[model samples]
Every structure is written in structure tokens, then in C-alpha cells.
Target: MEAVAKALHPDSKEKRYCNNEIISISKQLLVQVLELPFDSKSRKMTDLLKTFDGLDITKYANLVSQKLKINQDIYYYDNEHKNYYRGLQVMYQQENENDKQESIKTIRDADFEVIPQIDILVVESIWEDNKISHAFAIANKQTLTGLKFCPHCNSKAFDPKDKNYSRDYEIHIIQCENNEGKIVKKVKLDYIQKPFVPHIMQNKTYQYLLSNGRQHEFKPTQYFITYDLETVPKIVNKKFGKSSYQMYELFPLSVASTIRNKQGIKKIFFSQQDGEDFIVQWLNQLFKEAEQVNADNQYITEACTIDDTIPYSMEVPIVGFNSSRFDISLIISQMQ
Candidate 1:
């Protein structure tokens, strides 16, 4: 499963280890090679690959056949997927196009042609202390045809491909393909400007880049003890302050951490001088509790676990943002 989904978990240090496409190609080939001795009536998704003897993996284990050159099997399938092919991801595009065509239909009777087309115009309401100062209005609109110009050939006749929509900026872009159906250029189209205003919901900013608007909400769980820290500069009376430092105070002099769990969120604050005392007491106790839970697998729930042994998701997870650098450093400095 890790070999099949390596694209989702990339390893920067070892680049070739998680080559998802190549690994998938190799595994698919191995499935075909190991199935030669099996009967069609018994073999299914794949033939069981197990061996009692221990030996190093040969090139034959991953490669299809010794007759073909190494470079020839680099990519198992053709770049263009026009029809059903084994181990080809692009083959499902035909099914998606069919589904799109089936969804669109026109009115059958001629009598319904009297229904006129009207455009709905949206305008932003001025928000002052969470109050709506403006209301929605409807108006007529002039429709404009959008045409993508190819950057490579400077041609107006082109199709959009590899389209991506950004919710933050509320824009859609695509690689422009010329009449020959060769993608060679990039073009952008903005859909939120003019005759349009973003709707404000619950006083939250309109996220134009997200396909589903807003980010995932934060919810606390028992397995992880999530926390965030706020820091401020240390200060003293000017009458006695000048002797300590000449230029500026660079270190975080005062730190406050708000931790969340099944109980609730609570904040603990202290001066830098008291940091050692805080770590030895509160943080140590929290770590001990987490260790006990992991030793007994108390964090695992029956629904998310496979039997009493394997868990779909179970960890003493340390969750934070920039905690690896700033927050962690400050805590470890006092601990050491």
C-alpha cells in the first residue's frame, strides 16, 4: 500500500525511494509475472507472493521479462490513454467525460421557450461590528464569451487542459492547447471580478482558493496534547535597566503556553527565569501521562482498530505550527 501511495508521502532526503509511479509499474509487473503458474479460476487481484527461502531480490522480481531492454520498461503504459488499458490511470478520463455529458439536458417542449433568462447580481454588504449594512439586489447583465489565447502559437482556437482553481485568489488557470490538441501554453481567467461580490459568512473571510471554502476546523482529541505559545519582550524600570544589555533584547523573555485536551484549553505563563521550574514540573507530568497511554494502547478505539492489535491511527502525536523551531527550542533550552 505504501508503494502504491508514495505520491502522497514524498521523501526529500531519499528521492528515489518513494518513486510512486515507478514502484506501481514494478508491482503491477510483478503481479503479472507471479501469476503465470496459477489457474484463472483461482487467481484474483493477484497471486500470493510468499517464499520460505531467503534470497536477494533479482531484476526479474520488478522487471517484466529478461528479453526486453531496461529503458523500454521505464514506463509501463503509453502517455496517451485512449482506451481501457491495464495499470493506466488516465483510462478513467473517458468515463468522467461520459458522466459530464449525461448530466446536461435541454427542455423538450417548445412552449417552455417563453421563460426568459435573467442574471443574479451579487454585492458585498458593509460589515460593521457584525451587522449587515447592505442588502442583495438583482439586475440585468451582459454576457461575454471567454476565449483562451495560446501563448506559444498566439492562436485564439485552443482548448483548456490541466485546469486548477485557487480559492484564495478565486481564479482558474489552464494549459492552453492549440487546434492540434498539443498543450503548450498557460492562460488564466478570473471569475470573481466585476458584477460580483464575495458573500461573507459568519464574519469569516471568503476563501476563493479552496474548492470547499474555509479550512478544516480544529478539534481536540485525547491522543495528542496540542499547544501554542505567546511570547513578549522583557522589560524593567529605566532607572536600573541600562546595565544589562547595550543594544536590544533578542530572546523571548516571557512565554505563555495554552494547552488543549479532552478537559479544555488552559494557559500557563511564566517569566524566562522560571522556565526550568515549569518544564521539570508541568511538562514532565504531561509526558508521563502520554507514555502510559501508549504503553497500554488506551488511545485506540474499537471502530478504528483492526482487531485488538492493529490500529488505523494511533500515536502520541505532538501537533503544532513552527513548533519544531521556535516553541520546541525554547522548551528544550530550559530542559537541557
Candidate 2:
């Protein structure tokens, strides 16, 4: 029974049968049986049963058992099996060792160059009281002769001398030349020398500015205009290679301004009304405001008092958020 079941198994190569092959063989047997006369059907069936009865089941089972035992014994007592496994293990270990050695050699041969350190002296000019400006870096104290130009007037002739040199600070005194090529101004700079670390050393002037930057007194601008523009999308038709397509383009729709002057703050809004172009109307309005501001006499009071008013005349600043890239470009394009 086991042999018969093995013969019928799908993956058994010795006696495998596909669905189509089995159907074809069954149809041939049926046709052959039907070709016989009706009286011989029972006799044919009896003859097929007798053929199966004559088969020796015990002999087939003995043959299969003998084959399985022979295979198991051969695998257990093979002479070179242990040596083959040992050779494989040694080969794998050798390969891993070779890879490790190659990686180590690559790391040893790689270039890891160290970056050179630079010794610099930062010079900060004491321009005004509590102010430090025109700061520059000079490399190496011995090469200070190459600094010929004055930081104030860009004069090619100037004299630099070491004023003071101590363990913490190194001060240099520079004599700058004027327009008439005369050394009249003596500029003193503070330089902190740091040999190990590269960083900006905060001097006395920098410390003072950090403490009193917002508290310093200065006169504010008397007149300035802050404005913004509003835009709307307008469908524009463009043609390319005899094909036309519509795309949305931005156009100025309205403008709002906050004017600050001597009188007070005044808010103004201009829109495209009565079929008039908004950009043209806004430009005309701006021109009139500029003329009015220019013609008026305005003075900014010094020290927050009207008693010390100073006459100021300058171009009024038109301020806007992100105006340089968008609003200013739109205004310039509309101008003549």
C-alpha cells in the first residue's frame, strides 16, 4: 500500500502523473472497455481484479525498507565526511582573517593630515566713546609691516608702532594720514593675544557696547513712510508655437500707507476705483507726498527736548517689510 501511494504522489519522479495525462489515460481505458460487447463487461472487470490480487505486497515493502537502511548506514560511516567538514571550517576562518588583516592595512595606510594652526592678532579701533569699529585680523606679529593702508581714509602711507606688549594684551598705536598726506590722527587699538585657541577676545569697548547698546542716546528720523501693496491674480493668455494657454499673473490691486511726520500719524488706502489703474493712482499720490515732505521745514530735537532742535534735511526713507524684492520692484517697473 505504501508503494502504491508513493507511485500516486504528485512530486514522485518514478511514477508522476499530471491532471491532463491522467484524464487522457482514463479516457483511453474507458473507450477500450466500451468497444467490447455488452456481455463481456462483467468478465473484463473480473479479470482486472484478478491481476491486482496476483501482486506481492510483502516483497515491495521489503525492498523499500532495505533501500532506506542502506542509505542511512552509508551517511553514518562515510570515511571522508568529517575531514570535508573540517576543511570547510578552516577555509572560512582563513577568509575572515584575511579580510580583517586587509581592513587593518587600509586603516594604517590612510592619510590623516592635521590642519596647521594660524596665529592671528585682531585689531579693534577705538573710533568713538564706547564704540569699536573697523576690526581686522593680522597674521603673525612679524609681518605687521605689510599693513600700509589706513582703515579710516584708505591712505597708503601710515606708521604703526607697538604701544604696549604684556602677557595678556598687545596694544598697537597707528598714525593715520589725512587728505593732505599729513599724520594728524593717532588711532589706538586693543589686541588680545591668544596662542592656543582661535576666538574673538572681547575688549573694554566691546563690553561697554554690550551693556549699553540700547541705552545710547541718538536723534530719531522725523519723517518716514511705511507702506504695503496688495496684489490679485489676473489671467493672462500666452502663445507658444501656435498653442495658446491661460496662466494667472499677479497685479497690484490696492495699497495702504502709514505716514509719520511732525503733525501726527495718518493712514491712507488707495484702491482701483471707477476704472482707474491702482498702480498709476498710487504713484501719483506718492509723488505728491514726497514733494510735500521735501518742501516742509522739519527739525529733529536733540536730547528729547525742543530747546535743542537741529535743522535736518535728508531724503525721507520709505520703509516696507520685504519691499526690496517685491513691492519696490513693482513700483520701479511702473515708473517711466
Candidate 3:
């Protein structure tokens, strides 16, 4: 019990609280905490540990001792301070002995019968292009015979099912090509939802690339910009309620970006030397460049061409490596 309590200390960091009116544990409350359907002599140490998983054992032991009228002196190990509660060990042993006696009488009864375990069969249909497919079946282990055909290849010659299917079994369909023009194999278990496939395949930008046969490579008209920010810590005064304190805050010192397009690559940098609010200036220039890139790559339909495009516009993505907690926060602070 002491070992179990020590193991659970890290997971019990969150404090447990009861209402102010409930100062003591009642008999009904103790049964609820133990998660027992009724007051029984079959209490086990394992069940106690499981019930005490997220509780402050010190407080729990005190409450239980108060209810049972046990002396608090016997609750702890001698000279061990508050390290180990011995009363829990005493209660566990008492209940365990009672359980042993009860089990003896139960086994002697002629009506007592052992229950058999149920068997389950899980079948996964592996398909090309990363599609998710699963099926479940329950079968009696004593009567289930081996499957006749190979579930993967749909061939009768290759039977993958076991003759003794007396346990929970999982079988996979393998070596089949799906409708998405990809080769399916049992080893490749990447499963993607069925509904998302059409959205990805019929995206406007993807459709435009496919129509012009430029889907395999980056087109000359495509442009993307990658930017990064450098910041320094500046001490600032902050207030909470009636209290005020000083803390170091991040301030952007410089911003830089590399823009690549049909013409070539261009690098741009802005710093505090350029102006007091250089970040705002840099953001304005960034937005202008993104707009230009979107306009340059915009798809146009001719009179003879079909318009199957959805009501979606191309968006320019600004990416930064490890910027969410630091650089991005600095940018947002300045913007606000």
C-alpha cells in the first residue's frame, strides 16, 4: 500500500476538494469512494489503490479513520513521520482475510459455475490511397472453422486464417489496388478518412495544376515568402489588481524575408534603424507581396472551358520555424 501510494504521488498533483458542509465521511460516502455497489467483505488492496489513484491519501486516510473511530496513532509507521500509513495495511489485511473465508464457502456451494471467455474477430480492409475500412465480428471459439479465401487478394488458394481461432484475432486485407490509383498493402496502414479525399483532389489550386499538367513540379508563376524575426528582451512594468511588477518582454529588433518567384529570388530586411515602428512597415510590405502573388497565379476560365471551381480563393502562407512561443507573440503584441 505504501509502494502504491508513492507510485501515485506524481499523478495526484491536482488538489481534491469537498464542500465546506461535508466535514466528515459517512458510511454511504465511504462506499461511494470505494466504488463498491454494496457493503461487502470482498475489498481488495488492488481495488483500494485504484480508488485512491487521484486522491490525497493523507486526507483520505484521516477521513476513513474518523469514520471507523480508529486511533490516528496506529495510522502511521513508528518514527517514519507521515511517510507511511499503517492503518490502511491493517484494514486491507482484515478485509482480505474475510474475503478468503467467503471464497471458501462460495466454492463449496454446488450451484457455483465458472464463466467462459468470449472471442472477437477484427477484420481490416486495406485499400490504396490511404483509406480507412474496418469490420468487427463475434464468433464462438469452439465452433469457428478457418476462413476459406484470402481476405487481402480475394483468392481461395491463399488462406490466411488460423485453424484454431479460439482467441481474439485481427486479420488484414493486403495487396489490393483502391479506386484512388494507389497500391494497397497490409504493411502500409496509413488510414485517411473517405470524405476528405474529394476535397483535396478537387481543390481549385490542385485542379488548376492538374489541368495544365504542372501538378508534379513547382510552376514558374508560383511564389512563396519565408520570413523570420529577431527579438531582444526589454524590461516593462505590469499591473495585476493592485500589484505591479517588472518583467522582461520580447521586442522585435529586425525582420527579414526571402521571396522566390518566376523572376528570381529577392531578399528584404527591415530594422529599428529604418524607423521606430519597422515591424508595421514590414507587415504592410509582406501583405502587398502576398496579394501580388495571389493575383499572378489566379486561374481564369475561357468560354469553352468548364468552371468546376469552388468558391475559394488562394491564400499565401507565412511560415516561421519555432516562432509560435517567441517571435509570433512579439509580432502580436506590437499589432495590438
Indicate which candidate wins on lDDT: 3
lDDT of 3 by residue, 1-336 (tens): 222211122122485434321222232345655556655234553365366533344445445433332322222223445222223211222246665676568778855523221122222244676533221222322223233433332222222365633222223222232322223445654486444457546676665666688667323346678898998888887666767677888877899988765467777899999997898888888878877666545544576332445233656766776688889876776673
Error (Å) of candidate 1 at residue 87 is: 40
Tell me how far the alpha carbon of residue 186 in candidate 3 is from the true structure, in angstroms, after superposition.
32
* Residue clash pairs of candidate 3: 152-174
Put down candidate 1 lDDT per residue, 1-336, tens digits, no spaces.
222223223445656453556545545544454544544234443344344121112223233222111111011213365221112111112135554453332224332212111111212234565523221111211111122333322222222332431331122224333233234455666775543435423212123223344234212345455555454544442344556543422355544444455445655655547763654454666566566445443423457542333222346665655567666776676674
Model 2 misplaced stretches (Cα beyond 4 Å): 1-218, 237-247, 292-297, 300-311
Weakest 10 consecutive residues of candidate 2 by summed lDDT: 83-92
TM-score rank, highest first?
A: 3, 2, 1
**In terms of TM-score, which candidate is strongest?**
3
User: Native-vs-model 3 lDDT?
Assistant: 0.49
- TM-score of each candidate? 0.23, 0.29, 0.35
Q: Could you tell me how far off, in angstroms, the CA of residue 196 lies in candidate 2 after the best superposition? A: 32
Each prediction's Cα lDDT score?
0.37, 0.44, 0.49
Model 3 — TM-score against the truth?
0.35
